[model samples]
Target: MSRFRRTWLQHSLRAALALGATFSLGLGNAQAASTTKILVGFPAGGGSDAIARILAERMQIELGSNVVVDNKPGAGGQIAAQALKAAAPDGQTLFLSHDHSITILPMVTRNPGYDSAKDFVPVAGIATFVNAFAVSGGTTAKTFQAYVAQVKQQGGGKGVVGIPAPGSVPQFLVQVIARKNGLDLVAVPYRGSAPMMSDMLGNQIPAGVASIPDFIENHKAGKVRVVAVMGTQRQASMPEVPTLAELGLSGFEEVPFYGVFAPAGTPKATLDKLALAIQKTIAQPDVRDKLTTMGLSVGFMSSDELAARERSYAKVWAKIIQESGYQPN
Candidate 1:
């Protein structure tokens, strides 16, 4: 009917499309600017906190957003799990926990506040850490056999040993080793590793079980001695330390692991974004080297793989606990 009318209508459509594009761009930017908070279920200076801080630093730059690590420590991480359960499912918040908060806590406590299979979605695994049984330099035990000899000499075969917390991996390892060796180990539980080290140095505990890195430097400096490594293989940083398996204890390989978890309802898109960012960060040369030097093995597992790993450990730890006469309440 009219060329001018048709031309005007076409120009109007082009302008509308450009305006829609501009609006969409602004909305996306706003979404990206939203702060991402990661919850660490331990106090600062702990291993979990260290890992979360490292990952948070990389995530901030990789995701193009601000990220912060919020420490919520108490009740063996049940406090943090409850807080995470109440968090919105918008993928803005995540929980970084090791094996205790995920699998063991639920078994030991009546209520952990979050179910690993139902209330959370695994994002990515950061690393796996091997534990070590170490003693202060003043201890009479210089090696695993010597430790056994000292325990026997102590008359009751019940020697005081320190662990990070009750029902933690290190504690469980101590129980298992005590049973295997037919010794009575009165486990002394501490809030964290620092105090454990203090008591051990003060001779409050005759021996101690701790993470490999916690005493690695001390061992190297002749301040402490490692009796045995808990994992299957000797730690790379301490080749002289013998593994539990090598010491005639078969099937005692266990490592504490750290991974990222989101609220159960967090969208898959957000989880994928997080996993990608973690993979990129762990792949960095500096990050890899730093983690390795800390006596940790760099482990990058996908979400499915991480979940499977957790479940597998749950089954394994459950059996070990039961066999060790640990009646779950």
Candidate 2:
């Protein structure tokens, strides 16, 4: 070969190698940017936090990227929702919350930090969880009817029930149940389920209302007795427990659900990818079992379906809140 041609060939090869190296580095950086952060509004050890951590672990495998849970427990999940609202719409940050922060909070409170419709987009629905009306093992009531009777016997000012938080679903449901039954049961709000459950175990309060997951373990250990669940149907894990509707509570047939949401303006592709990863993660047998054991049903909804459900739930809860005359603090 000629000397000029040989020199030109070597130069071309070196330039090609350098371009390839740069392209590889760009891809590496892009992949690194894919790390996901799941933000939980409640403190650790609560139902929402438990689900978030489980989903995060499984999502790491499904998404093929690092996933972490960031707990921002305050203001009944308002802080976490606000953080998510201000986050970059890059799909790396997600909020895992139930209806309290999404459907109910905005309706009851004047300013909940972030508007669900305007500031966020639904990614996927994780599962539905039932709230339970339970009493400590020390209580004499063995059934819902018996419990109501006992509360009635105690009379107006004496009956008190603990709730996970003020302005939460459990709190509102307590009011509805009390009014319907014509019993005067006052609600005592605690910071979260953990503390409420703590008080209940000590019998500081005779009864409490909280997500089934919050009470299931203790109930199984005979520390508490879940007399009834607030949902349309019975939970598979605790088939013996009756739904509130079965006991003539009509409007509460629907249970609260948990879902994932990202800040508005996240790319469609990113949203879809995250939704798919969530679906896959929830479908895994181990993940399904873990969530179920925690009193969550393994129901998954796609992004569009989740958005529709959220809209419908907000409307229904808005009417209920208005009727209840709950003023936001």
Per-prediction TM-score: 0.85, 0.87
Report the lDDT tens digits of candidate 2 across residue range 150-241.
Answer: 87776643588998778888888888888889877789987778878888889888999999888888988989999899878898878999
Task: Supply the global lDDT for candidate 1.
Answer: 0.81
Model 1: runs farther than 4 Å from truth?
A: 1-33
Considering summed lDDT, which 10 consecutive residues are worst modelled in model 1? 320-329
Which residue pairs in candidate 2 collide? none
Give the CA lDDT, 0 to 100, for residue 188 in model 1: 82
Q: Write the per-residue lDDT of candidate 1 for residues 214-290, one digit (tens) a residue.
A: 67666787878887887777788889889989988766675777788898989899889989999999999998887
In model 2, where do residues sit more than 4 Å from their true spots?
1-34, 155-157
Candidate 2's displacement at residue 186, Å, is 1.6
lDDT of model 1 at position 91: 81
In order, what lDDT does every prediction score? 0.81, 0.88
Model 1 Cα shift for residue 154 (angstroms): 3.3
